[model samples]
Target: MRPQAAGDLVHLSAPASASLRTRPGLVVHRRRNLSMAPPHVVVRRGLTVTRLEQALVDSWPTLPPAERRAPVIRAVNDWLTTSERLAVALESAPKLVDRGALRTLVARLADGCRSPLEIWGHEHVFTGPGMPAFRRQVPMRLGLRTIYLDMFAERERVNIELDGSTTHGDPRQREIDLRRDALLATIGILVVRFAHRRLVHEIDAVRRETLAILATRRPGVIA
Candidate 1:
């Protein structure tokens, strides 16, 4: 996770500390020394800013339209506006890169989402395995109330859960999950269980197993 950095941090020169003080909702980050240029721009905890951020600013004035629009070039410009003194700092820094070629390549690895395939809530439902479909966290019934599921897939009423190591360790969690599954079963709703590692590492195998179960429930769907 990105550490809470002051939204308004300025670059500090070498041998100085980076700090932030939050006021209201905005953060004011600055270095101990005012005149010295920062050794480099850093974000989060001990993570240095990428060469791309530096390169873009250093050459922002001379950047051609095509070069400036490049992925790393663009990312650098975005960072400059948010980070103070970074644009000037970049101007004085050494050339971290010659061209933003790799950045462009990585940018192309987008989800390329089309109609009916985009996620409604990325915080909950996520993309996985070839980034094909949304991994819906199936809601489960526990006793008289409803509970949020860690991972879920639903077919009619059957909800499948992928339990991880963390889940089995908590006694209270285990009991709750067990009760939910049992309740689902009592209501004629199936709950197929799989290990989280299996779903992530051996996704195709898991898909095959899931499809097989679905095939059994509705035989003609596959044929």
Candidate 2:
């Protein structure tokens, strides 16, 4: 329900209740049978709503392409839902129109690619100098808090962090990033951060620097 765009009209599953007298802002979708899967539908505080996974798949066909990418990535990355769960939900959806696009998205999600920026970086910056395979959204536990790296090379302990000014340029976020970098350094993981502009304008340089760093690091040094 949260994924649905803001609207004056409310969309209710038809099976939940019979349609009321003609109303301007209320619309019922007659296609869904919520009774078939009890777990998919929830009744709380007298409101019937579908699970996030179900809602995502059911709403996939209705969304425009760019709008589709963010929600799926956000659900998996920020919400901590597994890509496999999303994939399974997608598989069960009979009316999915963008099957090819969704399959590619699911595969990238499973590989821990969280955003369009990260995906673009993977294709451009990381692929050219590929000695060690980099893992996306690598998790690291630092004391009580857990931090995720944008890209990580397990054998060489090389971590590449992509920073967008809007996301990481704030003072608070910069401080947090510094602390995380310090923690990563303490564990002998080499950290390289590239600004969004660097990746956009200086990709060739970024690729060369990345390959050089990997070349210097000893093989088989586990993080």
Candidate 3:
């Protein structure tokens, strides 16, 4: 139980035998059995609730198709869960309306994308532009700190970072990001960052910019 934020409802898990009556300020979930392993369900402060991964899967059906990828990616990145667990949860849960789409998203998560924008960029830029395969979540050691780039082309020393509000909003984090960017620049890595809105709405411009950068970074490389 992460500290409950204000206006957060109590998510109570009950047996299937329990009554289905809805109560104010309490969201009840009925389960047939309670044999989940660790990380699926957790007991904190004497309350049992689904873990982040399970909660993301449970809420998959409620979201529109375009909105599903972000939550799943965020859950995997935040909770350190794997695509295998997400696959199993999706298999068992009946709420997933688009199973294939969810599985694709799980695959994207396995590929190192932490948000919907990265997925779109990967699919659009990597494949459509016939660019060489790029690595996702590329970890680099900068002294004692480890920074993960959203996508990296090792040969070209190019890195693409996706900035979402939740992840990069804090002033401290912003300063840290700037320092990291400077360090990468010193090593001849071309770091390109895109905001969430720009990536979603102005993808064509993003694609053009990426292709131009890649072309200049590695002359005659993209065929």
Candidate 4:
């Protein structure tokens, strides 16, 4: 299904005791125990709806593999749900399809990887031997603004930004990034950015360059 288009199909969960029949556009899911725990189900406009995390987990397997991650990621990024809560919800679903992959994504989210690009960098480019345990989504308060660094090597005071494809060729965004970098530099932090293409296609080179940069920033090292 296309991401922007809402499908007509609706999934309804009912207790095993309920005799609900699926219609043309409806799917009925029968569960032995429909948890009525507080916050699990709430009355909204006179209709009961499952909580965001439960709903996401329940509907995960039904979605095409490629389409599952974005919704969960967006929900986490928007503050609608958290990776911890999602992990708890996932624990109850031992039979979930692609459970391992979903669990891995949630773990990455808990590590403060916000976007797909950041997650990609975490898996392929920014991690492994010789890499410092860089902090992800680190917050730096500068005057009135709180800027979040994508990946930060604390000792080196270096921030790595994984720029997504959407930012490519966008002059306005580039200027804003430059200004932010300058602002960071004022506080003695160096900002390094890698575009989406290089992070994905030139994995080895990116890793090497990141290590080299960190090496130069080490306390006793000279560039």
For 114-172, candidate 1 gives per-residue lDDT tens digits of: 11111112222244432223234445555678765433434434455656557556899
Local lDDT at 222 for model 2? 40
Candidate 3 C-alpha lDDT tens digits along 1-223: 1334587565565667887656898877787764445655788688666776777776666555666676677667776677878878777776557777887888888787776767877776555744768899988987788888888988778998888858688889889888889999987888888887777788788778877777777855654
Candidate 4 TM-score over all chains jointly? 0.95
Better of 1 and 4 by lDDT: 4
* lDDT, residue 81, candidate 3: 73
* lDDT of each residue in 81-145, candidate 2, tens digit only: 67888888787675678877887888878877888778778767787436567888777898898
Judged by TM-score, which candidate is best?
4
- Which of 2 and 4 is ahead in TM-score? 4
lDDT of each: 0.44, 0.76, 0.75, 0.88
Better of 2 and 3 by lDDT: 2
**Model 2 stretches astray by more than 4 angstroms:** 1-9, 13-37, 128-131, 220-223
Error of 3 at 64 (Å): 8.0
Residue 91 in candidate 2, Cα distance off native in Å? 1.0
| Candidates ranked, most accurate by TM-score first | 4, 2, 3, 1
Each model's backbone clash number:
3, 0, 0, 0
- Looking at model 1, report the run of 10 residues with the lowest lDDT sum: 112-121
* Candidate 4: residue 210 lDDT (0-100): 91
Model 4, 17-125: lDDT tens digits are 8889999989998876786555568776988877789888888888889888899999998898999999999998999888999999999999999988888988888
- Clash-forming residue pairs, model 1: 12-38, 13-37, 13-38
